[model samples]
Target: MMRNLLTLLFPVLCLAQGTNYNFKEAELKARELVFTQPDSALVIIKKTLANSAGAHDTIKGNTYHLYGLYYNMKGMTDSAIYYYKKSLPYIDNYPKIILRPYINISASYRNKGEYETSLKYLNDALTVTKKDNNKTGEAMLYGEMASNYNYMRQYEKSVDLLLKAIAILKTEKKTKQLYAIKQKLANTYLGMENFNFAIDLYKECLPGFKEIGAEKNYYLTYINIGEAYIRLNNLQEAKKALKIAVDGLKKFDDKELIGITYSKIGNIENLERNRESALKNYKKSLDLLLEVKSLWTLRIAGEYIDILNQMGRYSEAQAIINKTAPFQKNTKLNMVDRVVYEKAIAETYSKTNDSKAISAYKNTITLMDSISSAEKEDAVKEIQAKFQTDLQREKNVVLAAKNNALTKAMKAEKKLLYLYIIMSISFIVLILLYLRSYLFKNKLQQEQIKAVESEKALLQQQHLHELELNNAQKEIIEEKERELTSTTLQMANYQDSITQILEKCDLGEITKVSELKKELQHLIKQKDYWRQFETRFNSIHPEFNQKLGNKFSKLTKNDLEFCSLLKLNLSNKEIASLLQISHESAITKKYRIKKKMQITDDDEFEKILSEI
Candidate 1:
């Protein structure tokens, strides 16, 4: 009887005392919950912290990391970094976990403009990651480091580093990471004045981004590539890419990114001599950017100021400049600001033809020229100090911890239990929901993310009223890239469409035909696709094709595919690749189309579409 009673008491005590249970499941669950149900995750972190007040290092680390993630979700980056560091020592034996902490800290510092320091941490994180063969961590750290370099205008370093990261991600088959790295690499090339490479990379990254539903990045890539094309005087390509960005805005909600998109589109339109459209997009960009207090975008507002000055709306432009000046000053002079703002101001002065402003412009040029060096030095000093300070402070924590109670542990445990139960229940629910919802939510989030692009679209009108002295127009490098991207995407799409048509012809199987058609259908389902094409065509005007269809009113899908060849107007050799046929096959198809339309060898059918 005594033994039976003892057994019952043991279980009761265990329940009250809490077993370790590996907690991996809990930790994973918590991470999944962090974004989907942040509030719930917060409660769980609180409960877990309470339940395991002085638990093992692993348990404690999990609890702290969860809290850190919760804070990150709230935009409390400082608190998130703090908690992440708190989790660091506990996971010291596990460098893999330590790697994550450094990555988080690096990101926080980056947003804080502590780039040099951010770089150091990423380097350290890189070392840890190699030991553990943590491919994801390595890829992320490389990206983070590259971005820091980008901010410093060390485009070469940024590109080299990001390329290495991209290679690793590709080797690991990490599609998301590869997509991110590719997009970032595109930016680096854009900055480096390699428009062709920038455009090509952005085009390469698009499919993966679409598959993952990373809409913000997609819009950003589109805008960046478009701007590059415009720089290269490829107005058609620039217009096409910008149009994609404009259309993308309708599906996204992040105002800031949208604002950037709009600003880009406006600038493209301005170059196209569609002043009215340009004005509309600039206004959209400015309004959204202002809402978020974006300094990078404030420079874009300066573009509008230049335009206004060109139109002789000096007073209005001056007023708008005055309004944005304080906001720009308040932006705290990060590396990006130092470079973009000074260059813009100098250009603005030059465009306004103010001889008196020449002195100011020269000074501005001096600042722009030296900003990168200064930014790098500042970044280094800040991080070097932070590392030393944090290391010293940790020593203090070790000394202070000696004063705490091991004797009153049971009572502490009991108190922890109540905290755990309450917090865990709330957190678990949230985590499950986050895990369940992440795929759906990320997909649905496309619209929310694209909102930033919409805001970017409207900045043109604002530009006319407030910024007639624009300098970004001379910011030609990035624009050239967008045009290149449009060209590449157009070709890639043709290749795929041709392959599809060829597959249907070769197999002639009911199932194969159905599958090929289905695949084509899916591609068109993406708003990016031109319906008549095999894949998503970036340069061709889908609506133009649609209008032609309306006029004809009876074109078959194959006929449309045949018309798609009109896009490139490639020779029979080129058309064969687009249609998945031999050159002879392509020529025969062309002849058949000619016969159907009652056309002769005298007239080129591709040229006819241009008239339509």
Candidate 2:
């Protein structure tokens, strides 16, 4: 998608060629004007040339190069080439200066559709850059050459050069250039309709752009991802990525990109049969496109006309067709777009029951048939060519494997012959040595058997000890759980007695109510009872209280008590009776415990406590 925002050709600023006459400041000033004020840029370059006249050819050469760069930015290819050629005579004195002129002139020629000449200049630049061992420069040359090949429709060659450039950029650690080169490679993959590879490359480079805060590139990467998803018929994911791109691009003045993003979203909606949303997004896209007067707006218009006709709004669709008629002839609509326009017009005509509707339908059919025939022919050729290539590659692989086998066989044969010679020489010595070796081997085997038996006995003893230790631990845990259960039952009984005494005191069953109140108060202050219960619970589930406190530092003493009761797996009714509270309060306390621990409904709170 960033292809729509073509890379702006700018001058590459470098230090002055020689120490004779430095004009870096003036060149910087001139370059700043090249894009916004080309006339002023020309003036600055002319002034620099005049002032530096009779100076070293290096100074004059750079001025002439700036002039060429200025004209190239202004789209004056002939004048740019003239100035670029004028600087060539000074290359011997300033070798690096030759690179800029060559590169700029190539780009200029490329803009003029003179790809052959452009490639020649690029090749010359490559030779110079290679001789200088400038990896970054060479990488740039490869990218430029790739772009020229891309224009020539030799996509495979373009992809090859782009890969070479990416390798060089990686070695140079030129991150920005690497991003651009990889993006171009991804776009080439897109042209080949290799959507998955394109998406992978886009995702690979996305983080680099995001890390550097390259907003334009970051959003454009999303747009490209969206386009890939659209091609793969993944409408939901396509809508997501395109919507993100639109939101990010809306913050900037990139209307064209924003419009394209909306158009893609509209296409998704249209495919999903969301007619209302489709119309809304299409109109938004058209409005933005109209502000920029982009040629691509006609394509959106054509699609919009179809949606309108589908909705039975024939007059509205006709109105749009009328408005688009003038632009249709001037704008070079692609075959697919022309097909859409023809179908829309034919559909509108058919709604009116016109005789011309038959002719229009026939024309649309003929165009479709011709396009289908060409596509089928191309597909057949591509398949046949691919099969041949695969066959040849397979043969080469098999032959190479055979050669490798033969080479290995020859080496093995040489080794075998050498071994035979050695064996003959040592035949008598080997017989004497073999008897001595056999006696030593017999002793070694007997020692190894004894060691093996010792190790086996040691492992059995260790396993028996581990089993004993496990049984002992299990018994200890079960004993502690029994102690805890007995203590809980006692506490529950004591609590029930206290409740009965309080109830009798309230009901005047105890005539000495003051004495009964004092006894009930003493029973209620059962600190020692709770302390005993906590000690036994900890012994059963060690670290339960300490871990709950450590994990939830804000948990109060009451919360710890609640967790301890849960650790012992006490029923809520038993806990309520033990605490002398209603069952409802116990449930409320449990809810509070869950909230404090941030436990979810799906999490087993008791299980978590037991693990801790």
Query: What TM-score goes with each of the models?
Result: 0.46, 0.43
lDDT by residue (tens digit), candidate 1, 43-99: 667766667744667667656866776665454567878998898887788765566
Each prediction's Cα RMSD? Answer: 39.7, 33.1
Lowest lDDT block of 10, candidate 1: 1-10
lDDT of 2 by residue, 432-478 (tens): 89989999999999999999999999999999999999999999898
lDDT (C-alpha) at residue 579 in model 1: 50
The pairs that clash in candidate 2 are none
Best by lDDT: 2
